[model samples]
Target: MMGKNRKQFYFGGSYVPLGLDKHVPMSEWEGGMCEMRRLGINAFRAFVSWNRIERIEGKCDFTELDYAMELAEKYVLHVVLNVGGMFNNIQGFRPPPWLSYACHCRHRIDDPLKAHIHEGADLMLCADDPVLQEKAYAFIEKAVLRYRGSPALEGWSIWNEPHGDPCYCECTLKAFRAWLQAKYGTLDALNERWGTVFPIDFPSWDDVCPSVDMSPYAHADPCMKLDFLNFLEDSFIEKFNRISALVRRFDPDHTTTFNLQGIHGHDMDRFQVTNPGISAYIEELAVNPRRVNLWLNMYLRSARTGRDGQDKIRILETDSGPRPTGKRPGCQKLASVRDWTFVAHGADMILSWIHRTRITGGHALQASMTRWDGSTPPRLETAGARGQTILRHQERLLGASPFSGRCGVLHDMKMYRYATVERWHGSFNFTTNSHDGAFMLMQDAGYAPEFMNDSMVLDGRFRRFPALILPFMPYMTRSLASALRDYVWNGGILIAEALFGVKDENMEQFWRKTPGCGLDEVFGFRCADMMYFDPVKDKILLGAGEIIPAEYFRECIEPSEGAAVLGRFPDGSPAVVSHCWGKGRTLFLAALATSRYDYENTALRTLIASFLENSGVLPLFKIRSEQNAGALGVYLATKDGKTADIAYLINYAEEPISFALFPDAGILPEKASFTDILTGKQYDDFAEITLEDRQCAVLFADRKDTAPV
Candidate 1:
């Protein structure tokens, strides 16, 4: 298990201490563990709160955690320890009162004008402050030393959904200055870039303080606040590094990962205040929305894959429903689907939000894997049984890692971050809707596209892909632009949307044409002009069929020497163009498509269908599904060695849905037969297989086209 090649798959839940105003009984821990063992759960997540273990200054007691670990060991379950995450009990992740009194650099929201102060609110400590970091180091060091040689300890996690209010205290202000100095190198460079004349090294950037406020940047200089946002991210990363490093000091072999919330979870559902009257600890339900969760898991895992190899990403927290409000009878069945989806999508562990529900507290009446009555619930019982069933096929999954796709779509995490901080433009707010839209369009067009990020692109993951797409990737860095250009030059077809690379790394104006980064040259078009307007007024007219309405924005683009006008506006301006570069090609659309209506139109669909001539072949498991109603709703792949290829059909509707499966176009596999791996029902027709509502089916077919590895 210690080897780099080792792969782990397990099901578990967070063990919340149920003690109301006193220490929880030993029977409670034992009962939870016993239930886990009975349910075939081999792992559990436990949180160590700074305030709980040590309510008084310099006083420490691991009694609660010790019993929890002992119970885990007795039950033969592995542990993923969340040293510090967001919620703790009914209250949030509040530091010991002793520490807060020592240094009052707790986090503050953007609206500093309100003079916000709450005694026991869910306040975040200043991540960049040295004194607070020292305390955190000490706290983690003690925990690490205590559990140094425990075989049950699998990994360490620091940020459990790490999104919160901005920290604008004195320490962060000074840290921001140092961060800017390191980034820009000197005061003169900072002054020249920001167009500000601050004295020298330690001069004040401003007295108003950096914040999530956009008015300052809109009214003043954009670069200043933008740097501040970067500084905040850097600060959070630094803090996580410090805490995780302390764990590594004692246990050198373990891997550390951070479980992050999706964009909306971080933005609107930020954990700034601990108001029991409003919502509980696990109130926000963003991660369970099927399409969003699948895409999120893929993108989040992309961040962890590297040259050394993929890290065993233990996503420690996410919503497992039967949420407090809705009458979701489908939730229990959904868990197994979600669990299998996470695994098939490359998640190694699924430690759900809770083990037992918290009762007689502020967070009482919250949903948990176990009911408030302490009886075994079907949600957990069934999900765990499915997990055990899945565990039997660990080798089938462990051997399968490579997910082949035709196109590589770029996901700019930094753009998402900036959008959450400063919403400069409503249309270009860096929401995941663009991702949802683009993914749906491609899926509907019979294509699977892997999400590529800065690191994935740099790592050459997209080198062999025939086509690449950039959807709503507004701000492009100089390095990124060069990298993408090189990809196109190297015989890779490139498909990019409007506003791709319009700005440099610092959000500065680009030197090249409107789309910038010499992309205009590559695509054989100079963006003469651009504007955002309602699609109802100005529409896109292709050669034939119905006129495709421009969704949100359009541009007055001019075709260069070798470029061909694929489509034009009703007024006869180039709305989309195609250019051949080297052994590859480029299709640059000058309009942003935010709706299925934009791409599903007859003219637009016909245009995309034509591009399939060189859009690279998909993997052997090509799916033609009737379940492509909302977003992409099917997962298709071949087993290791092509012994069998399977297409997973997920029906999220009220009734059953159907889809056909086949090998990719222009290929014939010898002696292929279909069987549902779960039901043992052989599919004779190879034409259409119907899956009931909220049901998932895995159809397997042996393929002789590819040899087994």
Candidate 2:
């Protein structure tokens, strides 16, 4: 099973044991595993500390692995065993001291500095080292050979998040030089791309050394830093390939996967630095199609800015009520919402940081379901309820392939890269970057969003998607823009938001007089200039004809095209407009608007919904309930070849909500009865139904006709 057919809903807990020195009793471990299974969790992610397993070189310990595998079998759960223990703030499973010596490396530096200061630890081993690679491959070979047949061991994760710059030691430096020499024929080509002086700083491939310090000068050079980033990623991939090959040699049936942090800018350095190699590796694996899952480490929150006005609090502490010291709260509520929304987008599995509340040490401040009192916290209840809903509908969800219609959102990594450049160069006057906002909005709209390099869109993969929403994609390669124009001319739906096709890849703006390439003819708008709005100071009027009220201003831009206005600016200019392109359509939103009142506005929501309805691509499902306020919680599931089996509605608010009954798109019974799966209450199909807050209702309805929609 590959592609969408293999969709799996994973509900796992981050099971990080406090101390690696001692193993938990079997009874205790079994009890915890049973409880997790009872809560409907089907997956468990844990690590085997290398330090504990292999205390000495050439020795193996299977005590913890055996226990974990036994518990997984007992609970009918799948395991995603992380190989290398935490390095980047994640706990590292310790490796035996002799293994590093056997591999010709040093000790592990994954432990706390205080604990390892006198031990002379080495965090990472050089990937190119033959001894290390052989030992590593052998270790994996043995490990997988032993556990490969275990039905509980679903897959193996090679390593934790490998950082941008790693192992500048002699071994890695030599490997990097070799890689560069292979990429560029001679030192001259390398120097030309790196923009380095010829005679003053030219060095032989063996003598070339990357700067140890990553300052603006060193990091800014796309060629140099990009190569370095590629080298690091390649090294990690090589190690993973070795381990994966070993696993597959023994257990080819079991799936292999890895966790990638999905937040913008942090894990990703520059576009060229991180994207090319990383995406290539991902594509290769994805075609082989490794399970792509998102690991949400930090909840989204309002981060505090530094003195220079850069966001300092990108990550914050969530408050678990008041602490015993009556100081330091836990994570904020907004962060939780944002985090959950990310999972809702495409994350097949939501792997939290820690499952149970820690009683001892390390990350005591981290939020978990079980609190200090050993009782389930409110967040636990929330997570459990949400998880249960997902579990009940897992089969349908996994079966329902991601939207396969020929429509994709054009996400250019170069635009994001250039935006980073502008941020560093201070060339633009924008507060909040619109790229994230656009991506999030498209995701919320239920579009299959993928990050594409500007060049990749021209490779004809994008032509498969009938529609492409390009939101603020600033830097467009000439080939990409031309491809888009050709796509539109060939009856493909194209939607371009503000500031698109304005600048080329070199950050040079296309003159207004320039014909065709300038989005003018495509969008029918010659964006003369754009303006930033303080959201609070402006209000958008929905022109009295729209379904939802337009209240606030997100961002405002001017439309030069005389397109049919779907919305207008607060000053009564065109805000949202649509124009025809050949047999296709192009939509342009001059300003960002909302259709839902919560965090998103209502107008934008209705607009998108309406667009889907008009496009004849909206899913066919009817949410019939008496719930009024928490209407947003209603979800409908339909199997492609079978009759829709379940209709789920959840009320996340504090009070009861009622909703009017609506007929199932075309499969509704005249007077059908529905069995509430949660409460087991049988109710005749009425005009409406009501549900209490934090409560979910799963209705099993039999169609009177038993015909598919």
Candidate 3:
């Protein structure tokens, strides 16, 4: 129901009424609910850990949950009930002591009580265990049947930050074998693909044991490692789907969602790949504003879609206040910036980690909406103010959507899998850094492009974009290669960096020409040889004898007769080439130029601007500022009919600065006026707007022919 129109916004905090015995206390629930209502907060995410309600098997005392639902109904607040196997409380994944003991025994491990749970906090019951999963299902069914009719119950959150780490239990091993058998059909096929030999040979399906050794020196078979990761991901997806289907079976009217951890160990293309509702936490996970922007962009792309369809995107748990661990403390200004950033990025909902202070847990001293005595803090006030502003502008906000032009950056999980196996430590950043860099480069050039995954491409979503960029993608599949070739031939501009498809999807080197999989002809070049380059020392020779810095890796490219050399290495070997393929064009960089950009470098941004210009991809608008242009982030949300748009200009710098928004040639040609949403003041011209340090301004722009303000 929430995704029906994709226009609603929900804002609140996470409230944990952990039974009647713990957290915020039974006495403070009514006050907390009253405060939430008074602040104009519409919804909150409440949790019910398995350990808290049913410590003893078959006996669930739902008094705390029932009271929470009643209070929510009384306060006229909606609730997104988080019911799952793992509870991310201070105790951390405490799955009923009895269940933990039983699972340890079944898995032939030492007693869970004797184990140091903190060191291995993720070690819990094998999710593949049938009996254990049945118990979980029964518990969920009971909860759903009790609250499905309640008005306060808006939906259900089934999984919280799902992980794909293998349990290595007997049940999990059996499930893994089944998964492999279904994939390969025979041990010979599996062994051949994985190159299994004397030491780690899988004579039988049962002989396969997933190796979780990610140490720096561990020499695990790359193919086996990739498959193991895939198997675990598949298993996680299966469990989540089963639970989601179970919830819908009983409560068909309500929606089901999951909170995604950042895209480090997990892959968004695998989980909630194309789902309509997606939630994620970003408080402690993202270190800086730039990374926060990156995380939001990635999640927004994964959650929401292009013009064809849309999804409900929620920042489920952002920081509410300062943490006891002073490393990443939260303040009123920081909280405000983060909340507005989410709103600007098109988040449908924004919830803090908590509403009230905890009585016990590792985060006992962490910041909350209310203090121990149910008093509001500065951050709470900030939330209330932001909520009020959002409520006031709900109509315009709902009618508008972020405008991302026809350009997409590819986010392939196979490349992630390959990097994880080959370069374990910083492998996760290998693909992501380039992605973030490319995204920022586009942003700096006044272009808003969405991120597309392999599944989206295979399903024909890639055809929606006029240009596609592949940043450090090395793994290639036959089908994907074919699709990409067709895309380029049909007039799609493709920009790629070094090591493009040098390896197959299985992480094996390609036998054909260097670009591999018929791509050498598509790009009119092949990688002759490659070597590591120094970021500070190596230089690439550009047009008119201009030189720019190169980094990390370099490829000596051999170009076809029809290809034009764009740049050359120090020794005059072609480093960047541009070629015409069919009706489209392909630009290939034989170096890691995209990944080498930082705040100090203008090379990547300049290169991106040139490519976009040459390919005729016009940016939405241009920013004119005397200050640091990178410090100001510009976002535009266009009304459905394209008669008006809303712009959010955020100044991430410390000092005040003035800037102007000049619409691109054909975009917003006859715009009439700009009105600040917060101040309710209208300006007829878009010449100047000055913002203080870390401040943001929201302006509504109406065209000349639209309704008058």
TM-score of each: 0.85, 0.67, 0.91
Score candidate 1 by TM-score against the native.
0.85
Residue-level lDDT of model 3, residues 432-456, one tens digit each, is: 6787776666767777777777887
lDDT of 2: 0.49
Please write out the lDDT profile of model 1 over residues 284-350, one tens digit for every residue: 3323344533454344434333311122344566555455554333265555555555555555677
Pick the winner on TM-score between candidates 1 and 2: 1
Candidate 1 weakest ten by summed lDDT: 271-280
Whole-model lDDT for model 1 versus the true structure? 0.59
Alpha-carbon lDDT, every model: 0.59, 0.49, 0.71
Specify the highest-lDDT model's number: 3
- Number of clashing residue pairs, candidate 2: 48
Candidate 1 vs candidate 2: the lDDT winner is 1
Cα error of candidate 2 at position 454, Å: 6.7
